[model samples]
Target: MKLSILDQAPISSNQSPREALQESLKLAQAGENLGYTRYWIAEHHDLPGLACSAPEVMLGYIGSNTKKIRIGSGAVLLPHYKPYKVAEVYNMLATLFPNRIDVGIGRAPGGSAEATNALSDNFLQQVWNMPNSVQDLLYFLDNDIPTEHHHARVSASPIPLIPPIPWLLGTSKKSAILAAEKGLAYAFGQFMSDQDGGAIIKQYKDHFKPRKHNESPQVIVTVTAICAETSEKADEIALSSLVWGLQRKRGEETHGVPDIQDAKDYLRNEKDGLLDDMKKGMIIGNPQEVKKAFLTLQDQYNADEIMIVTITHSPLDKIQSYRLIAEEILK
Candidate 1:
């Protein structure tokens, strides 16, 4: 099974956005050294603890610091941007990094309503036209815009010898069918989705139509997980994220990822059901246990790759979690 990373560049309560980004670089370098197949950074806007908003810029920085691991946007939130512009940005990255660039397209706003509106006009309309947008993006990437089309006279320039690859990213069957029909690679956000991922991936493969760049269906399952030397340690680390999530949902002003002691104190009076709801979404365990869970999930989804997203109050713990998992799985 192949393993990769999905990073949100999470900020700790004690840290700044700048620190979180530095950690992102550290984690990406660590992932490459640990034999991870890819390292994808998420794009989030006006989110308190998540640092990255422009993945294309971050990719350039990360690509310069790493040698081989594939780097990309976990999802670029394509609805907010023009297809040609997106293509040009990634094409420049591909020109710089060659075969190492991946453009993971998504339709979600990736931000609050106001933030979304600020980013683009008619975001809903753009989402409704996603199929056409994706087609145009692909055409721009390939420099294959139909001659009769209005933008055919223009081209996404500084194109690399080998183009950046496109992957459709989402958490639903609608996205699966879109990716299938477009003949693009599919990445399921299993970490965030409550839907039947197995059936969704099946839908993608079952309906996939081969295209020039992608001749077969490709699927990657992105999941949330935390691994450590001990299950107790793993759970403690995970609690920080849980508490932060609970606070966010309640519209509490979060300082950032709270310390473990703070997380414990906050959750002490909370219902077990609420905690269980949060815990159910994450895989928390020691190395051996995490390895087993990951393999099982891989089998369940028949995924081409398993991409893990881990966040914690301590950046060291976050990096160690990935290292522990890699030792077990990449071996």
Candidate 2:
């Protein structure tokens, strides 16, 4: 199984947003050195804990910092930007990096309602035209259009000798179907939803159609993994993410990812289904345990690639987690 990264630039306790951003580049460098296939960044806005809001800008910075690993947005909230602009920006990146770019588009606003409102003039209208927007993105990326089409002459330019690999981040059958229709690669965000990722991948494979714009069907599953020397330690690290989940559930964005003790204290008196919800998309254990869980995840999802998002409180532990996964499961 192939291993990749989906870094959210999470700000942990005693860490600043700038430090988190710096850690992202360091993590990418470690990912490349550890033999990870791709290092993808997440886009989140108005979130005090997440430092990366513009993935393309970070992509360039990460690309320059590393040599071989593919760098891109885990899912650039496509609804917030124009497809032409996305195509052009990524096209330029592809030209610079050649084969080491992956362009993953997603519908998530990557922000709250207020941030979403600020991102676009008509948020609901953009949501309505998402499918059409995706189509436009695909067309512009390939610089191909039906000769009879009205905008056949228009081209979103800086056409690269090698186009950035296009991927659609989906968590549902609807998303899978759209990827199938466009013939773009599919990446299921199991960490974002409670739905069955295996079923989603199954439907995507079953309904996949061929498009001249690309090659064979591709499927990637992005999930969270936190590993340490011991199961107890791993669980302690996992608390940070648990607190993050809790904050989101309460409609309050966390400041920086708190420490393990703080997280445990926050949830100590309160017990709900949040832990169960967190487990749906995460695995926390020692190296051997994490490897086994990831293997099972692979067998269930049958994905071509597995992208791991490890956002622990310590930058070193987060990097260590990725290294352990690469040394253990990915090997």
Candidate 3:
């Protein structure tokens, strides 16, 4: 199976944005040597705890350092940007690293309504226009006729010699159906729900109709993975990382990654119901256990790719965990 890395650019109290970005690049470089297919960064706006507000910029940085691994956004919030501008940015990247960039699109806001409105004036209207936005993006990349002759048309320089792989990222059934109908690859967020990924994949494949761009349905499942030498250590690390989501759900805004002590304290006061919900969708364990769990999902879903998001209190621990998984498990 193919492996990829996805980063939320989690902020830690001790590390600065520059430091976190440096470490991310190091991890991407290491992942390349270890045989990962791609390294993707997520986009989040106005989140103090996340530094990946602009994934396209981060992608360029990563692409400059790594020679073989493909780099792109796990998703760019399409509703917040103009379709022509989005196409131009990705098209340029694809030109710079021919056949090495993948554009993953998502419809979610990625942040608060206030933040979304701040970024785009017509936030609600943009959400409603996502389907058309995607269609327009595809048209721009393929150099097809513009929808309206009166509207401005943007084209890429050195014009993309080859089409970049387009992926539809979603955590819901609506995304699955839309992806299939449009003949695009589908990526399911396994971190968000406990619903059987196999079922979602089956639904996508059954309804998929091949288009000129996509001949077959491709499915990727992303899960939170924390691998250590022992299950106990992995669980401890995962718990600390899981606290961030808990804090977010409780309407608390944290600036950096919390220490184990702080995370433990937060969990102590939080309701048990919230904690239970967080644990349902996560996979955290030693190499062997993680491998076993992932294999189960792979077999059931007939997964084409397995993407892993590793979260920890320290950058070193996060990188180490991924390295361990790569060497001891995925290898």
Which is the leading candidate under lDDT? 1
Model 1, span 1-331: residue lDDT tens: 8999999888999998999899999999999999999999999999888899999989999999999999998888999999999999999999999899999999988889999989999999999999999999999999988988889998899989999989999999999999999999999999899999999999999999987843999999999999989999998899999999889999999999999999999988888798887888889999999988888888999899999999899989999999999999889
lDDT of 2 by residue, 1-331 (tens): 8889999888987888888899999999999999998999989998878889899999999888789999988888888888989999999999889999899999888888999988887877887898999888888888887788667898877889888888999889899988988788899998877898788888888888877745778888888899888998888888888887678678785778888888888988766775866665678889899888878888999988889888778888898888877888767
- CA lDDT of 195 in candidate 3? 73
Ranked candidates, highest lDDT first: 1, 2, 3
Q: Which candidate is the best by TM-score?
A: 1
TM-score against native, each model: 0.98, 0.94, 0.93
lDDT of each: 0.93, 0.86, 0.82
What's the candidate order when arranged by decreasing TM-score? 1, 2, 3
Least accurate 10 contiguous residues by lDDT in model 2:
272-281
The per-prediction tally of clashing pairs is 0, 0, 2
lDDT of 3 by residue, 6-68 (tens): 888887877898888888888899889888888889999888778888999988888888898
Please say which candidate is ahead in lDDT: 1 or 2. Answer: 1
Q: Once superposed on the true structure, which residue ranges of model 3 sit more than 4 Å away at CA? A: 146-154, 194-196, 268-277
lDDT of 1 at 6: 94
